[model samples]
Target: MNVKAQYRVGGSGLRENWFIGAGFGAQFFYGDHNRQMYFWDRVVPAYELHAGKWFTSGLGLRLALNGLQNHGVTQNGSHGTGEIYDASKWLEKQEFGYMNVHGDVMFDLMNMIEGYDYQRWHVIPYVGLGMMFTWEVPRSNEISANLGIFNTCYINESFDFTIDVRGSMVNDRFDGEQGGRSDEGMLTLAFGLIYKINYTDWNRPRWEAPPRRGPRRADAAKRLTSELRLSEYDALKKYKDDREVVRQEVAVLVPLPSATVQL
Candidate 1:
């Protein structure tokens, strides 16, 4: 059972240099393997201490200590008989807990818009991966072969070799026999989100050099100036035409300009 939360330690103006958090969560197992006392009984409340640094826009590396629990279930015979005894009373309970300690390195990639700082955190998402060492108490006490028997030799305490002890040994799932050691060590991957507390400081670079500038005159200004000059050239050409002058004089019954003016 894995319970993840949304309270990630990040902000717009403040990057999380060091973070310590504690949370309560449960793991629920799937399939027919009935091991835990309850479906969600794998109650693992854990704390993590992590450190991170942003190397580029919306991307950072985080190193953390993540710990959790792995709960396993066992079963014994019930008190009920086929046709005589009650059904529920025959059920037995077998529950055990394992400790999972991990040292994990993860990445947090943020979502950013163009021309905007990647640290701006109205809402952010992240994922994680890690390896854990899982340790659990052995259930079967019948055999001492795999578990290693307690012995003292010579002047010390020792067990009788003449007598062979026999009992039902608890076997692990991977092994066919019982009580041969059930603990396992495995790796896991985790994915979740870190809701940013502030948008300004969420892991943006501390101090950035000013952006470089290009040549001063803008393309837009040059285009507009060229268009205006083209319009003046066309107007001067029309003003020098004799037909345009007679049409303008007849339409107004006067010279086109009241005073002499440069075309």
Candidate 2:
């Protein structure tokens, strides 16, 4: 019996290999007017959902939606009396939210060099440009750019855990305050799960028929002729042996003329 091994073939079609992922993380904004760092109020809830396809082992494309809740504190100076500044009297708190819809180009570093391995970890870096739509007192939209790195660890054949770190650049009015050349972008760190929707074995073995060397009909005819010749030779030998045995038996029974007996 001949056994053949199958390998995975990297799928090139649109529907063969695809994945969808969702993640949640803390998002922080850095802007000119609000320079505070590590403020509890500054960190907001952020989430992301994306669908992507890998055209090759090294290259892929993704469309994603990122949502963020943003918070900012207003600076109000003390009265002219200058007696004392009240924390609760003048400090104003502002909160808003925004959504980003973007398309990204993904590059798989591991797959580009070493090749795709479903069992191994992959580090993918991506860059994207899109628009941010803010929902605040004065709703506004602006163009934005994003840079991110995604790390995927395969938990099974169809699922993976991912760690994503991203940086985004948007218009200065994103925080409802315009003070500098550009508004502060956001930094997001998230953890999520990826599910493979369509799994194609890019490594499946492709079987090819070996070349035929001779005509099929001629080979079959030659084989049959050789078998017939062999059978005929065996039959002739058997017949000659049987005839000699019969002759010997007859001579013994009939008692043929001997030298001492008259003719």
Candidate 3:
């Protein structure tokens, strides 16, 4: 008979689901002070470090620290008489550094809809709201929101490669400009790796089973005695049959006993 082992697998334990990751990418600011969207000159360096926990295969939470450099350039038309239609020239440049600390809810779309496969790649989308802190001449804080999609590829048992494209929205002061109808936001495209600290084997159990309790000593002794008694009875019955056969053989070989009694 085969017995199945009871164990857990794949983020089954709460302590095993935690991971840490770090990434580097570029940030693009979109606001009234910028020349245009998708301009290479407006892109700045950005990076992030995060720790996350997966409660299940489909749901997780992450706390991240995101830091980036922001840039904005203002264009004012030249005032020279001959340059009436000469177009705009760079008037002011705003460059500063900022950081965001946020908590996010991450959902694994593929695992939620289909099923969780550890070896396969997965797409996760996340949204979060937090506060943005700027380190400019006049330091300020503003409410912020983040939306992102993460593409993760499993590299090994404990490591994964991830590419994330996310956009962050903050108050217009994020770029030190305030003339826009909408708040300022930045788009970040990053690549990073995640390392799993606590690995869980779904097929193994952490707890130990209690020792088996068998029959009492007196009961065990009685059972053994009963078995031995049965065995001895069978042996005695066989010996009696053997003795009868011998007696019959001796009477057949020496038929004189009956003849002497008759004489």
Candidate 4:
């Protein structure tokens, strides 16, 4: 974990920069005979809800729940039974309801270079491993290796706009048949919103930063100075009154009046 903060050059905590997000988009599958089908034919609606925390401005961790449905093109009879999509006997669409839960280690590219900035877009690239459950027949469970990029921008203190592009690679048999390529995978693009629970920014770039504790108390207990303070006293009489006289004034009256009467 210490190595993960190489670019952070700042201090942070697990509780500091946490976020949750949800979005909807489309997914495409590639494997087996899926390669023979039109790209659009393999398209299915995708959705995701994820939450994560930034341990540092440059590094983070996330857990995402991605789901609803998956699309594929396979020989109609090649898919499993019980709740699986059953098209005509010819090669056709194989759709199923699925949910993939994944945990990722995220690295912020922009953070590595310029550190955290709320006003600009952050480019985060991540890698993870997950379990994909296809709710069909005898419930097939497969582990997938995931890779993705997230583009996000601050919309407000509490909200952010984000776009994500991701891919998951799994065992060839994940799609029910083991032929074709060595492995199967799917690609996804989702648009979403992320929200911060309390404080909404990273506590990095400047390592001295600390997480928000909470609003300060309105009326804290007043400080008691009885044992904490000391007072100094001086008697006023000791500093004597000093006096100095520059000049003394006296008034003279009748001398000019006798001369004026004679004139």
Each prediction's total of clashing residue pairs, residues at least 3 apart in sequence or on different chains, is: 21, 12, 2, 1
For model 4, name the residue pairs that clash. 11-207
Top-down lDDT ranking: 2, 3, 4, 1
| Candidate 4 ranges with C-alpha deviation above 4 Å | 1-8, 80-89, 200-263
Q: Cα miss at 19, model 3 (Å)? A: 0.3
In the range 5-91, model 1's lDDT, one tens digit per residue, is 212333333343333222232333221233324544423343333444444333444444443443333333211112322235432
Candidate with best TM-score: 4
Instruction: Give the poorly placed runs of model 2, Cα more than 4 Å off.
Output: 1-11, 75-91, 204-263
Q: Whole-model Cα lDDT per candidate?
A: 0.32, 0.74, 0.73, 0.73
Q: Which lDDT tens digits does candidate 3 get at residues 1-263?
A: 22233223344566877899999988887776565433876788889999988777777899988887776664432111232221354345556678988889998877665445668789999999888887665677888899999878989989999998999898876555567547887899889999987855333332222222455445646766777787788888989999999999998988764344554
Candidate 1 stretches with Cα past 4 Å from truth are: 1-24, 29-38, 42-44, 75-109, 112-129, 139-263
Put down candidate 2 lDDT per residue, 206-229, tens digits, no spaces.
222222355744675676677778
lDDT tens digits, residue span 26-124, model 4? 998887887766778778888999998877667789999998877765664445232333344346556777788999999887756554566789999
Deviation of model 1 at 164, angstroms: 53
Candidate 4, position 164, lDDT: 93
